[model samples]
Target chain A: MQYLSVVDVARHFGRRKALSQISFSCAAGEMIGLLGPNGAGKSTLLNILATLIAPSKGEVKYGDQGANDGADVRAQIGMLGHDLFLYPELTARENLEFFAHLYGVTDVHSTATRALHTAGLVDRGDDFVAGFSRGMRQRVALERALLHEPKLILLDEPFTGLDQTSTAALVGRLRERQRAGCLIVLATHDLDVADGVLSRAIYLKDGRMVGSDTGSSNLADRYRRAMDRGPRNADSALWGGE
Target chain B: MMRAFFRVAWQVMRKDMTVEIRSREILLTTLLFAVSVVLIFSFALVREGRAPDDVAAGILWVAISFSGTLAMGRTFERERYNDTLRALILAPADRPAIYVGKLLGLLLLMLLVEIVLVPMVGLLFAAPIFAYPGMLLMLLVSGTLGFAAVGTLFAAMLVRVRSRDTLLPVLLYPITVPVMIGGVRGTAALFQAVPDEPMARFWIGLLLFWDAIFVTLALWTFEPVMTE
Candidate 1:
């Protein structure tokens, strides 16, 4: 069954079309990669799915349910975006504890403790996040996203500033969540990471889905060729960074 | 749900308290600023033999109101520095939970600063501030609640705009004038040993009514502003 679906989603910021007639769906436990260039509406689409921004026109459904029931949809999904969501002045443990309370976790202390260990910051859990490196902060953010044990996890460029070890740990954790029947949608510019991490690929150009493939072929090559052959006018405004 | 609200409020307040202890920057700056304002007021008005009873309430509320803006500005600065507020917003909890949490934290900080400033002002100006403890306390509670309630919403809005540090007071002071007047009149009545006066009760009633109205407005408006 489809756990997530977007139909003809369109969004405009002022006069510019940030996303236009975009559509996609994901089944239970599927890891779908959203590949696109800068301003390709990857973040905008992710934002719509995360319910952070409303679609100009379209429908978003979760678990075969309709979009109008947003609270139910929101309860099942977890999101990690480009922004670092943890408080800087707060210690890592305090940050986690705070989020745990926000999400109404039954066992906040234990949940926070386990999250700190998973992020490889067990020793530094009591230290303020202001003192953390980008990698450490990202780990804390990941821990925060997973604290609720959500059913659908949306990640936007989750690999931007991580060391190799941290990256591997994150990938491993993501795979574990995937295996446990969590649907994942990741948006990224790095084809290599997406190729290695995602089981299926969706290419976006000019604020619309341009190509999609599920095979083990070179997705990047296919994506580049698709872009080259695509219409020039389809995405001129996005290319201009409007 | 009330339990959840208070729990989040307590956690937010505790977290801010911990940060305040570590930095001591906001508390120290607001306190010094409040004290200096009082001293300057002494030079400007106290030498005229203006009865302490006449301007005592005005000076006290003005000092706290101005310093309160400084403290409220710091609330969002701490969150923006680490992007923590964004994280809090994204959590599965309701938006009002976050609003109340931050509101409670700001209120606590403003009250704490007032606790120290009230006694210090009395000592500095040699007024009988504690003469009517009940009236003085009533003024503190009503005044601070109104200030913090409106200040929280404005502070959040200003946090996103440029020149937020200066913009908060400029935008906030005019809107808060009625509350200041109410607070001053209420406090002055107490200083004059007129605890049973109807005017003081009327001003206190006005402050309470305004506090309820703005707090609801703040709650309704905060969700859109924060999400946007």
Candidate 2:
């Protein structure tokens, strides 16, 4: 019955604020799409949730526990960021086996094989990832994320570099996981992809949450209207010109 | 929990070994670099009328310290390429296990390189390296352990820095001064035409102490530094 919640979390890198006063709560079976343009802090928020970096203020609670309860929270979270996080020199199977051990997965060989098959890389399992195409590497990365069956999956720009076929495979797998009661947070700039897959969409602009709803409407239109405010900060160069 | 920790460590080390087996990049580069440096030192140090013992120890450790840096750099370079380090950090495994696994991998490479370098040095310099076999082994193991322990941590720390290639040695050398001193002093004692047993023991103990302290600190700081 526990849920993941973010309460007034803010993160700043020196003078630049990456996120501010972002608040939300999500439970299992919710596929929340984080919609934002470039520099909108979507990735930062996901990273915070993943505990890769801590928020500067406020708190993130997983169930009743907070970020300070590191291991328990980390054990249940899986993240795919801009970095593929796959070792190029390691074969796909080897990569999975190594991470399987880390995640305390028993029967590493079987788990790796199943994950590879799911990603459609079973035949190429023994091949070094260095030789893989960008799309292929992305598939392997997706398999790595889902290998441990984490309760929360954070996908930041997961669709990048993926072809239509691979993208469909990823979307299908994501939907399947959600149906199995996994909490998924997908952060992307592609409203079309978000529209097709999300149960709810949250729009962010300049580190602030502008709007969030479960309405069945055009996400792009909603995004534009939510961002109708001219500029949140006139002096901030990010919104200034360019 | 302890069993899981070591299992994760072994898996990491095994993965590194498998990748190394395929490419042999770190092995080839570190060996060639170490041998080349030693050969250069042998040529430069041949002054008329003195035994190789006089300069052998200093030159040997110099080769190792420099080439060991290269090995350390290569060990972490692959992780940096695809951001695999991030994956390792994100894993539910203990972060310090990653350090131990990498330390063991570097130790394996360093020991392998030394195996060749030691015999090659003995042949070239005509020094009786076998004079104090036990002491020599102890010194080499302790020194390499200290080096790899600290080097692995620094290498991981520098992975995110912009000037990491240059920063590694800059940060590493200052911290590893005690280990280098112990290695060089111990080697000097052993390489002497007449061995100094007590001097060698003192440096060996120093190397052990250095390994104990830095490795403990490395374990303590690895998670924080890596996560940051």
Candidate 3:
């Protein structure tokens, strides 16, 4: 079943067209990478999918439900962006507990502990996040995002600040979540990570998608070629053909 | 629904208190600031040879009101610093639940500050703030509710602005003048043994009206502001 869908999605920040006629869909148990360079509307699309921001035009749906059912839709979705959404003064356990409660988890302590263990922070769960290394903090953030066992996970640049070991661990964890029937959409500038983990990839340039393919090698080569094209008319390529 | 609201409110309150317990910066600073303001007022009154009764209520409300702003600013600062405000908005609870939670938390802090200020102001200025204890408490509750409602709204709005620190007070003070005026007068009436004074009743009604209107507005507006 298609778990997520977006059609004709467009966003405007004042006068700048952040996204125009963007359309896509994802099914259950799929791992897709939204590939793009800077200023390519990656974050904007992620924000719209997460329901953190509204689009100027278009419809986004989760399962069969429309995005206007924000609170209900939000219940089934979890997101990790570049920002570490945990409190610095809070311990990893406390941070997880807080988000768990927010998600209306009845057994907050147990859920939080499980998430901490999954993030490989069971030992450091008692330490304040302020004292944590960047990689450890990212792990805690990942745990927070998964606390509710969301059916759909949206990650925007989730690999930005991670060390090598942490990055591999995160990828492994994401793969495990995908295998468990959660639809995962990750937006990243790192092609290597995308090539390794993503089953499908979509390349975006200048606010429009240039190419989308399932094979990792083809997608990476097409993404690089599009990037090398050096900022041409994105609208003419992605939307004009459509 | 009430259960959900209270659960979120209690959790937010607990989180805020834990942070305050760990840092002790907000409470200590607000305490020191409130005391200093009272002291300054005392000195000015003494040098001018004015009776404590003349400005006692003004001094108390001024201290409470200004310290309330400091408390609100700190609340938003903590949320913004940690990105917890965004996390709260994304929570499953209804939007007004977050607003009420933050407002209740601020009300508690404001009451705590008032508890400390009432006695200190009475002692330092030699005015009997606690003379009509029940009436004084009522005045405090009414005034604090109004302040918290408006302050929470403004704090959420200013959290994202470029000049939020200065913008908070600039936006808040003008809007809160009526509450300040009504609070000081009502408090002064209580201190002067005029429990049934017509002016005190009028101000109390005004304060209550402001509280109801702003609390409703804050709850409605907080969702958009927090998301934005």
User: lDDT winner among the candidates?
Assistant: 2
Mind giving the per-residue lDDT tens digits that candidate 2 earns over B80-188? 8877888888888888998899889889989989999888777777666899999999999999899889899999999878899999999999999999999988988
Query: Where is model 3 more than 4 Å wrong at Cα?
Result: A218-220, A228-242, B48-53, B193-198
Q: By how many angstroms RMSD does model 3 differ from the true structure?
A: 2.9
- The candidate 1 chain A region of ten consecutive residues with least summed lDDT is A233-242
Deviation from native of the Cα of residue A26 in model 3, angstroms: 1.3
Instruction: Give the per-residue Cα lDDT of candidate 3 at B71.
Output: 89
Please say which candidate is ahead in TM-score: 2 or 3.
2
**lDDT, candidate 1, at A191:** 75
Among all windows of 10 consecutive residues in model 2 chain B, the one with the lowest summed lDDT is B45-54
Every candidate's lDDT: 0.80, 0.86, 0.82
Q: What's every prediction's RMSD, in angstroms?
A: 2.9, 2.3, 2.9
TM-scores of chain A across candidates: 0.93, 0.94, 0.93
Whichever of 1 and 3 has more DockQ, that candidate is: 3
All candidates: interface RMSD: 2.2, 1.1, 1.4
Candidate 1 lDDT, tens digit per residue, B1-228?
778767866777777777888888888898888888888888776655554556777888988998889889988887887556766666666676677777787777777778887886676666677676876777788888888888888888777677998888888888888888889888877666454467777888899898988888888887677654
CAPRI classification of candidate 1 = medium
The model with the greatest TM-score is: 2
In angstroms, the error of model 2 at B215 is 0.8
TM-score, candidate 2, is 0.95
